[model samples]
Target: MENENLLKQISFIKEIDKIKYIQRRTKLFNSDRNENDAEHSWHLAMMAIVLAEHANEPVDVLKVLKMVLIHDIVEIDAGDTFIYDTAKDHSNTDEELIAAKRIFGMLPKEQAEEFIAIWEEFEEGKTNEAKFARSMDRFEPLLQNTSNKGGTWAELNVDYQRVYDKKKVINEGSTSIWNYSENLLNECVDKGILKK
Candidate 1:
């Protein structure tokens, strides 16, 4: 029964093997292309580690990494909502919330509650851990856009301002990363990889 709880927890550890990134055909951080969700999660976790010290306050890097790794598991059901998709007609939040409930509920009562709390915490960005996790979350997409030559941004025809507007929540937690992200986005605009 003890192990069953762990097993149940893994039920949400979606293979995502068949699921490709929205920019699956695009490059990764170092210009190596064809990244998948697993690769993306791994990369984001690594990014969180590298940038953890830049957080506004002391943060639990391991917790933030866990948050990053699991944050998109709901996408297993709701599918990825391209960050620029502002259609009130298509709210992935409801579907994601439902999926979160179903997926997190699979674990043992205590474990499920614990992980659900962390997941909810990350969603709310109320704690330092959640804030730092979200900081990495917002930064990863920016890195991908700039690194992969503006794949998602180009696909969505999003402007630089639109990117900033979408990611401004990071400012509430890590002003340093937020400022750096803004500067990087500006550099990307100057290079013309992203639109004005």
Candidate 2:
């Protein structure tokens, strides 16, 4: 039974490597190269460790770290959906749930269930850990865009209101980060990078 579990865990580890190939719209900071899901997840994990103190409420940093690391594994199957893309229904989680099951399900039953729960918590964005995990998700891209002179916002011609609406979730996790993000948005506008 132990060997069976180990094989399943190894299978899951191998499967998750696909996430490295899933490209996102946002580019790396100060670089034109697009970030893949694995890179984004790794960056978010580091951010959660570094910025946990900024969370609105006390959070289990390890839980937050796990959430960030596994949050995007579903993208391996569902593909990367650009947050600013209006045509796509961002509220729909059915596809993501399916992907989550298939990807996380590669592990043993208990481990798979735990990962699914963590991923769902992140999606719900209600708990402090989930909120902080989500904040890292939104915040990383914001910094990337700022570094690239409004990277995705400028390329996609996304307006201020749309960007603000999408980014406001950051406030739910960390008020200070949200304030800084707001200032960054306004600065982008003032600098003629993001459209008002």
The segments of candidate 2 whose C-alpha lies over 4 angstroms from its true place after superposition are none
Q: Across residues 54-79, which tens digit of lDDT does each residue of candidate 2 receive? A: 99999999999999998888888888
Off by over 4 Å in 1: 3-27, 30-34, 88-92
* lDDT by residue for model 1 (150-184), tens: 86787668888888887887886689888888888
Q: After superposition, how far is residue 170 of candidate 2 from its true place, in Å?
A: 0.4
The candidate 1 region of ten consecutive residues with least summed lDDT is 17-26
Candidate 1 residue 107 Cα shift, in angstroms, is: 1.2
C-alpha local distance difference test of each model: 0.74, 0.92
Quote the positional error of residue 169 for candidate 1 in Å: 2.5
Error of 2 at 6 (Å): 0.5
Evaluated at residue 102, the lDDT of candidate 2 is 89
